[model samples]
Target: MSDVNVIPDMIADPSAFEDDAAFRLKAAQAAIRRECGWHVMPNTALSGVINTRGGSVIRLPARHVTSIESLTDRDGNKLAYAYDPETGLVESLSGGFPAGIAAIRYEIHAGYDDAPDVQSVLISAAKRAGMSPVGLVTSQSTNGSSASFDVVSLMQAEKDKLKPYRLGGLP
Candidate 1:
């Protein structure tokens, strides 16, 4: 049916939402409100002439944050703007329990999904460290790419061995 002919029936049916100008406007407003509310957190609003008014609040959805936004005593300054769906990493802090003293020399290859034949080497390296070997980390880069790995279990191993040295102290 033509767009013009379908309008009357859409308007006639209350259950079905018609693809119309009014519906589009409502959808746009909803999108705006959703984005706006992402930045606001819920709290008790204290007000009124007698100073005896309080109510429940609605809090904002927390984004995957790694660290504090700012180092300030105030609440607002300490919070970061909600995270957007992008390439940010989510880091978790553990309570000082070391991860079995094992290290990884991760490798990635070009052929996507062809598991590399380095699992035995990883297990051997972990075994050399005197720790119970757990698992192996493997990855595949896009076409025309290549990678390598050589994990060792020396406690004082230099950071530059794994990645380009960021000159400061061992991380």
Candidate 2:
């Protein structure tokens, strides 16, 4: 709930920084990580059968997955699995996700699990690239209470830091 940044703060404010305050942490983390992902927290983990396409590895739930807390089946039995913490690839230990009715469910904590040294880099990025700016206030509705902010994308410098952990292992 608190971890979800599903909404872009039109009233952008990273000043609202709390360790767990909001998605800014991951927005920053995502920016630092420079990849797409589910970014799951304890409460937000999704449950479902991830089709393995007749293989041992299940496609990562998102652009990235930080950790796999557990894997289970429809019977609610825990299944053994392995994964690359870097690439988010999970493979069945005993066998594949199995070739039958979709039954495997996942409980993963996805996203950049660690903090980068340059959080400010990400915060600055959010203000500049994370949000969109309104071009020319056409009406000026005089809403009494007003707010303003800018959004920015992850800078090339910032992205470079995450390259080692990046998929394809780009150097």
Candidate 3:
């Protein structure tokens, strides 16, 4: 994902914008991720303590949590626990975690693995973002009322790809 040139398809034609394709593609990827609320990565982290949903089920706020290293109480004292790698739910094999704020501690490696359809999201975002001089600006709206070139280029279908990765509920 470092070099946007490797992305199979971008909204803008590679031929049309020649030199700026890579830059635009990269920008689009970042923008789409921000809009989608997928900030997880293997090295990144998402942590929380169980309060109401107490017992073995730990609430992990992020997606793609790979592993849980250690569980600790509010005092940072290490505790024994087991976590399911697939579901990211940690089970207290030893006992139950205290129901409180930040009562349990576990270091987790979390991040988005980029779904199979992620390429489509990138391409859609790239199409509307990174306007090169190639596109002619016939009508420019100062008040920003539907005539914006960016708005015209963006299609609802492209934004739809980001629905699955949304942070909480409908935005």
Candidate with top lDDT is: 3
Best by TM-score: 3
lDDT of each: 0.25, 0.52, 0.56
Q: Could you give me the TM-score of model 2 versus the true structure? A: 0.48
Query: How accurate locally is residue 95 in candidate 3, as Cα lDDT from 0 to 100?
Result: 67
- True lDDT of residue 2, candidate 1: 44
Query: What value of lDDT does candidate 1 attain over all alpha carbons?
Result: 0.25
**Worst 10-residue stretch by lDDT in candidate 3?**
143-152
Q: Candidate 3 overall Cα lDDT vs. reference? A: 0.56
Kindly list the per-residue Cα lDDT of model 2 for residues 41-149, writing each as its tens digit. Answer: 2224445566545578766555355556768876778888887765556778887676556667677654444445345566666555434344212122123344442
Q: Is candidate 2 or candidate 3 better by lDDT?
A: 3
What would the per-residue lDDT of candidate 3 be over residues 23-126, giving only the tens digit for each residue? 65766666666765666333475565544345756645555667666567878887666765555456676666667766776676776565656666677656
Note each model's CA RMSD in angstroms: 25.3, 8.9, 10.9
TM-score of each: 0.16, 0.48, 0.50
Enumerate clash totals for all models, in the order shown: 2, 10, 3
